[model samples]
Target: MTWLITGGAGYIGAHVVRAMTGAGERTVVYDDLSTGDAGRVPREVPLVVGSVLDGGRLARAIAAHQVTGVVHLAAKKQVGESVGRPLHYYHENVEGLRVLLEAVTAAPVTAFVFSSSAAVYGMPDVDVVTEETPCRPLSPYGETKLAGEWLVRAAGRAAGLATASLRYFNVAGAATPALADTGVSNLVPMVFHRLTEGTAPRVFGDDYPTADGTCVRDYIHVVDLAEAHVTVARALRSTPGLDLTLNVGRGEGVSVREMIDRINAVTGYDHPPTIAPRRPGDPARVVASADRIATELGWRAAHDVQDMITSAWEGWVRLHPAAARA
Candidate 1:
């Protein structure tokens, strides 16, 4: 059966595509290439250049590809940007998801895997949030993700479609040779860019209650995250029940200072990070209690901080050797 991956040309989506294609699966990529690059997709895979908001086009692509399952990964993701443009976030994330769901309902494609976020938890009082945690999203981005999950759950219940929403936290690291141009929104990549450019990475708020007084986050490697998607797809095919929402993470929190130190150690960058005040809506700490996915799917993250940093550094260096030299 063919699988449709929306936003399949993006960094995380591209990795998912690589994993799916590498395993000999029939996969079709649907990306608008707003922030995604067509060149990032594997040459062999078929791509449908269209927006998720385009229901007619989406339905056509789904039917044409004979897609039986879908992995929805398209959405506006920048936290700060989402705050400034709440309507845009709602439109792209919520409305786009609505359009996709409508198309799926009409087409009878049941199996689905949603790319969710830990942002839905929104600065929870607890450091590690589980699947059962109450959602109290802070930013517009988080709210949109939560709304998307609600839509998925509703659709699954109403239509008996098997769906899994993987709530990811602080996805980092790279999985391909062309990684330096992977975009500048993620922390690790932006930090790597600053270091490579002979500058220190910026550190926001060093006065939180954590050790080292910085925000702590769960930085799961992209490869491990991609593996989780594979597991989700397999489970949907094999399992009977519907509507699963599980946290995808390493189950450990790494402080911002700790990450910077590790990056410095890995890249031999000696410049100290520039300290800055905390931005609004910035949480003191956010970690994942990923035991649900482990117990349910028997999956675990294999890469540690060193592996994440080294692989990311290698990918960056491969793309920009001169930057690595600095």
Candidate 2:
């Protein structure tokens, strides 16, 4: 089936495109290039330059490509930015999804895989967060994602569209240096950027109840996360009207202190991290229980924390050659 992948030129989107194409699935990339690099898309895939907010453009691309399935990944996804610009976040993330869903439901698209986030379960207190966990999103970004899922489900039920929402945790690493994440918004790249500038990485807090006293999170390899998308996308293609909401994570928690230590080791740097005050709304632990995804699709993450840091560092060095010397 020919699938239309929105935001397919971004880091995670690019990985999903490669994984789907590598598995012999036909895909067409739909990106506005606001934050995506057109070069990330493969030469073979047709790149449609458009935003999800544009229904006419979306419908045209869907029809032009004879799209049967869609993977919606285009959205504004910064917690701090979302807090500062709630309207922009709601418009881009929530309203964009509403428009896309309207277009998809109107078309012959049967399968949809939405890019959800663990942030939907903001400040989860449990050791391992399950899908049944109460959703109390802290930031507007998380609220948008949660609302997006609700819209997808409602639209899918109304239109008989098969759908899956994969709530991703901390995604890191890269399949290739060129395909690696270039943005410093994430933890891995943030540390890399600090090290390249000969400064210590800052840990948010060290007074938590955890062993390391720092916030704990579940970090999943981008490759594995992309594979989960492929698995879910194919599942929706095969199983009609199947609705799934599963978490894509390693079922393992890594503390901020430990991650910084690992990053230091992987990058061959001895710089110690500076302890800072805890950021507002930061959870002590937000690990996922991958049991649902594994039981539903037999998918599991293969890469470890070391794999994530090492590959992420390689990509950082490629972008900043001086980082290698540092």
Best model number under TM-score? 2
Judge candidate 1 at residue 238 and give its lDDT: 76
Alpha-carbon deviation at 216 in model 2, angstroms: 0.4
- For candidate 1, the TM-score is 0.97
Per-residue alpha-carbon lDDT of candidate 2 for residues 11-110, written as tens digits (9 for 90 to 100): 9999999999999899999999999999999999999999999999999999999999999999998887888899999999999999999889888999
* Candidate 1: residue pairs that collide: none
Question: Candidate 1 regions off by >4 Å?
Answer: 179-181
The Cα error of candidate 1 at residue 96, in Å, is: 0.2
Clashes of each: 0, 0
Clashes of 2: 0
Per-prediction TM-score: 0.97, 0.98
